[model samples]
Target: MLRSAARSYSTKIRSAVRVPNESYIKDKKVTFDRSFPVQKRTKAWEKDGMDKGEWFKKNYAHVHARQKSERAINGDNDPFDKRSKHYERIKQEGSYKREQFRNHRSEYTRAHPLQGLKPNPLIDYVYGTNSVLSALLAKRREYFVKVSHYGPLNTQIQSLCNKNNIQVEETEKHRLNLLTNYGVHNNIVLECKPLQPPELSHLGVVNSEGSTYDKVEMDYDQSVNTRDKFMTKENKKFPLGIYLDEVVDPHNVGAIIRSAYFLGADFMILSHKNCSPLSPVVSKVSSGTMELLPIFTCAKPLQFFEKSKEEGGWTFVASHLSGSKSKTHLTLNELSGMLNELPVVLVVGNEGNGVRTNLLNRSDFTVEIPSGRNPEEARNTIDSLNVSVATALLINGFAN
Candidate 1:
């Protein structure tokens, strides 16, 4: 039995083992062969009076020459080689900068942030706040809309002064701070002015043809009062509107405004912390959409929504992906068709996390933009689209 088991084991081992493939062995050894082709020196090493390795090491002049020639072929320069002309050019740049700084001899430099930067030609223009206000003011005498989150309309007020070539009494104290915060140098030639007081009865008037209006001041003391100028009228306010729930990206906010304005949507309500539509980047990205819309700022978003409800506004929230029911995924065109024809408020939530539960609970309807494919292979690369892209999709959908 022991002899039979030994024979069986030997047979099993013979069956399991096989000769290695020649090609595999050859390929595997290619790296080692390339580095060291032969085991011993040939006639070339013997003539040099050195072993193969010694000959290769001692005659590195040829290797260096080959490297230099190959570098030239590949358009590469020796970084440490000062004799190279390219090295001198880089050195000159360094020396020139030092000299330039020495000549200036000051800690603060005159370099403007926008000095070398080019704004988008298609989107950006030389229109100052004063210029826009003046143009709008002069074009029609009937209406001029002024919306502000912080202070009163400085840009428009300044623009009006410039158009009329009159200096405003009010110097822009905080305006400079705002511009600096946005990294925009306060290099604009601005003319300041005080806002004309509103009339006792009428706050503003609307024009029929040009759709322009001017301010009508009410009875007030000499004090500069901001409370007299809330843009919303409790009675005449649009029944439905959207509130920005911490949508901080100004570009997204502006795009959303543009979308909302075009969709026959009434207004946008934003928290004080959220970016203003009048911000330079936002205005540029919105492509002048800021002119057509009105936005209101409130202390708290939920409180604002509650007040809106009290004033007869219905809130509709765009729900997030977590077990939230969106009627169906419809393209912009499809969403426009399904939207409520009556007065309504559309709420778009935060970018990463959707609407807060508290806000969602307050919403009359939780709408969502559908995604994924079929019911099985569903996934999204980004949990949601850019706020601006989503806003455009939302607004365009409800446009009809």
Candidate 2:
């Protein structure tokens, strides 16, 4: 039995391990042979003895011509041809639509010239909860429209609107954003007439002793007493005022006004030509302080300065850099000593350019804030503070 089992195992091993066929091995070897013939490749320049660049130029034109002929024959059967045609059609359609829109816009603009071309000056939009509430309470501007708001309106705001017979409407935040020209609206906007402050001449005369002006006439619905309250005799005694010399940034204008009003400034004078307008933005940034402060417009600031110095007994103190080239210079500590000597007007200048050279020359005192760094260190670093910040420091120094 052992011999028979051995024979059967040998037979099974031989059958499982069959040898490869000689012809099949030879055929497989031939299929992978590295000695196979390869066609010689040569450039046109090599074949025709032409310049490499010229040969390539000719070859490029010939290749493109062949491709063009092939595309004409194959038409949309070629994937590239089909894709290019599809893109061309889409581009043409887009251009045609754009042209149509441009023509339509032109016609609409021609038909309605004044509607959207310019902003309406009579109506203004005031936003922010504090600003809107303040405008409603101030009653300096006429309110004939509704208050648009998003989310829950403030209780005080809703109550004021109701008391004033102004309507309140719930609106989307986007509408509020549009109304405020994307300003920081705080989700509430009020529509009202623009607040127009009276000029310095219209309000009263500036005398050497003090504000010897008559009672301000109330042209609008504003009470005469309210106007008179700001210009009282006590407030004008040794009064401190701010003169904005071509300060055109609305934000800086608003901020300076806010600081001045908070620090008990008597009045503000704005240059008529270059100063920022008392727009809604100024009111919003000022936190409605613009409504409370007494503002006067001076068309010619140099003349106003001359007149104030000669006749009004006002001292002009200009905020200057620490090492400015002004003839008269005073440190903040020095400026404090003379705050009560006479009526003072603190002149702050434009953001880019400092106080105009002429204004600096005209100023009686040019005040500068002392830097924490020494002169050498301060010269190497940021040498000056922002006009608004410097103005606040000067105002604080004078006020205290």
Candidate 3:
């Protein structure tokens, strides 16, 4: 019976491979012209394809009628109207083609599993009918928002969500599986903010809450610990304050955060206006270190610095290239001698500019790195090290 089954399978495979003889016209000598056409001028067409008079008789009437219709509608052959129509047609065609391509690609990707391709995140927060975006802004101090309600570009967000374990919620009518658990009260709502800000505009109509009271719930107040409570946490060692001037590079920020976390720095603080905290780029670069680090942003960096200093901590600058015999120039042993008594707060500044003068003056000490023979050459080339590399050096130096 097994041998008979095998023979039957082989026969079926052979039959499936067979093609009908009528599919190819024997007289055409297996020509590709029917399958795929290539444009060319034939000898007959080259020799007087068709007489001008005959061509005019056949096609001129239709051409003239079209021109007359154009004149009747637009009063002249301006060409702009035709151009606009042409562009519109092209745009529609392009859109259709793109949509078809996307569908095919999506189907292909769904069929084939790739290890590197990230999975979609579960929805931690969902907005329907109510101003969920507005609520997010109001409670910005509480939660580390992973994705903003930018628009329907959730795919980009999905990659990040998968990496950091974030949740996504949508209020579209078709989607029956609404994330109503956790802080989400209900996805059903009627009267919500119809418009959203440029950054958070995606949540405007796609998913809105009908009842205002049900939609305004916030997770930050429940999730994060209060300042006093956070302070009282057991073994809260090395609560060093970090102040960023204009460090916009998220990768650098993430690396610095990783260094701080590993070197026993418990907390980090940033300038509220100048820096972005809990951004996806930073999260990805840090590789889950952001979750470990307690990040705080203050309105006034200088005031925060002073407060940290007054709390038995010493503020020091890491940039040693500045003129004058700055403590920034001190060796690890020398620096350790200075920091042994006081809780040290190390300040690494922006990529282009070093720390500001006012902050520099107030700092307890300024340290510098030793340079090459020609001080000018060293100073010029000294700008080459990445902020992350410099951070590693500074953190390891302090920990050692």
Candidate 4:
């Protein structure tokens, strides 16, 4: 009886549904994310803020102001015109002096270095804004500035020259590219006096003690110039000097001068042979420290070292390689034991091959920077430190 009832229920369910095999209906539409309409919405905070049109002006106010200043200098708007308010504001505010900081040099003429050492002009080009500005303020050279016809920089060049008497020439923008020799001149070019290499012999007293020294021959004018320029607060004090033996790279030479001067060395002696000249690059690299450093050339460095020891009581020290096997070898720390010995000369050598073997032999004591690394690592390391770096380390450790 239960089986018959179940069969009747199944028959009823089968009769209620239609079979697919008999027929098919139309296809339904398919929808993808790309087909959906985008919903536009705005955040409550952003709703009251800046519009798209005002965004550029607000965000780039400084850039626009700079451009405006340039236009005034370029004759774009009357505001940027030569005598415009933009230029006048700088004059009133004395903003040009921004580049002229700590400029001790006034209008007084620099005593020309001795006749033979009169620096022959090397290159006419002076790049970088600070360099040209320093050269002008230093009054170290006569500069003829080339600038774009009309702009803020040109206006600055014009204003600086007008007061200081540097000659400024206006040229088309394209000319600066040619003038600076494709270097990054930033649209300004200046031709100033070349770097002057002073003669070594004329630098200071060839002989400290008149009885033991042979005077360097010089006329009245040369004597006056030498006295005026090289004579300084420290020159007359007890002697402390540094001798660079053929450390030729200009960057190194400039950097060493800065380090030597700041570390209280009274003066510097640069070798004429295989040494970098006193160029604008060196001058600028020294952060204008070259201007302050009392530099002298050494035609005979070995003789000068010998004289410093024999005649003057200057201690002759050097930074030679560690374990040099020389009898005078001492670590940098050991130098402190000898500071009671005042007058000293620190000698640093060339980049490739250090102080000549003869120079190393002449040193009163050879100081070495200790190798901090383990023995095995030290073996695979570089043989020598950079000439500039070694000079700085030696200077910092130098006895006052």
Candidate 5:
């Protein structure tokens, strides 16, 4: 019986084992195909019976000369080599630096905690006291993230979550803490859905020409304000919109949103390239003002503004180092005077490199807030203002 069992076991093991392919197991003999071979040009030196190594050295004499010109590198403590240790010491130091850099980078990945999204980063987590409550109250998103447990703000979010049919996990609080990087969760962290922007068909005003509104994914409460002529309002609040031309900073964008919303700006347009997305950080920094502001994104912001100028009669004014781009020394005061002429669109550019040349050319006017400095004074005194601060200033002027 034991002998029969052993035979069966051996047979089973053999069946389970995988054998390598015959081709893979065989020794590989690599050979180049001679069928497609091209004839090589024979040099005069080869015909003269020159050795290949000697021919190479003679033909590439300049390369050899460069090697001879370089200072000899010696191992440390080589007594016979009297040459200065400058280059060798430098090479050794450089090698040490390279090794140190490799180790530093290896440790960097371990210490920095990986910046981008994890496969599952809890979808999104909106934590502060106000952000948590506002996220729940806004109801702009489909449903707030369901939590197995609640922190200090549980009573507040419970009903809101239930009404929205948000799921409930009923897990412990420590998991929530880990999700937020131990932030002051206030006993609430929302793994909520993003606000789905209303479709373009449902947005924008129907122009007199009646068709040709290309759809773009935009965030803004259309029901709260409007889809069209949030541009033209009766309260003398002319359409005051802003285009962020590649403003990459989320903090800046968020602060600008808060400023724009509070200072009476209507909507915002974001360029597709070199710009930050409407992430959770933007929403958090805006203190929930992002929900209130109407944001439109366009692949070609320059073209969109141009079209608005020709068809929709919207005036796109690009804010720059100096509003000197326009032929007529156009000033902010001029924009105030021309307010009734057309809806205003202010284009704030990247922080370092103002607005792009093409965009500035498309503008109906240019605005440059003069540095409050003397003619000879260094720019350090006051070269430019923060984009958010600048936007606030412009919005305030438009609001008045």
Candidate 6:
């Protein structure tokens, strides 16, 4: 009796539910394969070993003809025209603005080819608090164009500018940043003519006349007189000048200059070629010492050395690395002792390569700073000091 009741209940449930036929279900069902077929794609030009331009022309000649015909029909040949089909296609590719900008830039560049290519030779933007203040105090530049500060101007700077009749403008920091090319401006910037150092031949003139060195351009006769005066001075100062040989880094140059000036060196000499320029960055790095220091340029270094040795009896002492095959004739102590006997020009060399072969050979004395580190321990590591540091040490040695 129970089996019969369960069978009747199952029959009623099957009748209540609507079940689809297997054939109908099969007709509605869909299947997708999980695996994707991978194929290698090769460019037609690469496969045919033909030039890309030739292949493009051969395959897309019909497309080009069609485009030309459409362009003619639309009466527009300009690629930059907003209504042109070419411009519309570029817009679809999301390069419409880029193409427009590029077109405008090319036109502008062609119209003014050298607009920003060269910097203003006559002017320089001196920045940083120390650099600006020092420049104002030194009055090295020919004329002060103006002074601009992001915040309240320093009282000293303001007074100096007012006395010199220089214009002062309160400006935003971003403007100062732009003027200094994002250098460490310290909220102040100065506009003025660049400092123009006289040639190396004017060393005697610079030594004799203090601040008016630039004003007196001596001829050969007057230069000789000045040289005699410098050499035969009663006080016997025996000025020691620092010569930079291919020191390309401006920071190193500035540091060396500052060190030389602070250590009582008479003047600074720079090789005309392969030496860093006296840029505003150098001036700032030197903390305005560059403005105060008297600098001279030597166009032909070897010739100048020879002439100075013969005529002025100046000694050339070169700095070299230790543990080298080249013999260092004198140590720093010995050099210091000899400083009083002769007028000396200390030669510091390039960062990577030491003093040039010819200059090294020409030097009367080659001095190397003795290292404190053990030779065996420090052999693998950096053994030489930076050019600027070495220069400072050497200058201090000379001064003492």
Top-TM-score candidate index = 6
Best by lDDT: 6
Clashes of each: 19, 0, 22, 5, 4, 0
Worst 10 residues of 5 by lDDT: 199-208
Clashing pairs in 6: none
Q: Rank the candidates by TM-score, best first.
A: 6, 2, 5, 4, 1, 3
* Residue-wise C-alpha lDDT for candidate 1, range 199-290, written one tens digit per residue: 22211222323323222222443322122122222222323356677787776776787777655555566655653434545544554455
TM-score of 1: 0.44
Name the lDDT of candidate 1.
0.50
CA RMSD (A), model 1:
29.1
Residues 253-342, model 5: lDDT tens digits? 989999988877767778777988776677778887877676766665655765566655677777877635547445555556444444
Q: Ranking under lDDT, best-scoring first?
A: 6, 2, 5, 4, 1, 3
Q: Model-by-model lDDT, in order?
A: 0.50, 0.75, 0.49, 0.63, 0.66, 0.77
* Candidate 6 Cα errors over 4 Å, as ranges: 1-119, 202-236, 322-328
TM-score per candidate, chains pooled: 0.44, 0.63, 0.43, 0.54, 0.60, 0.64
Q: Write down the lDDT that model 3 would get.
A: 0.49
Candidate 5 clashes between residue pairs 3 or more apart in a chain or in different chains: 148-169, 148-170, 148-171, 151-187
lDDT of 1 at 362: 73
Error of 2 at 287 (Å): 1.5
Model 4: what TM-score?
A: 0.54
Which residue window of length 10 is worst by lDDT in model 3? Answer: 199-208
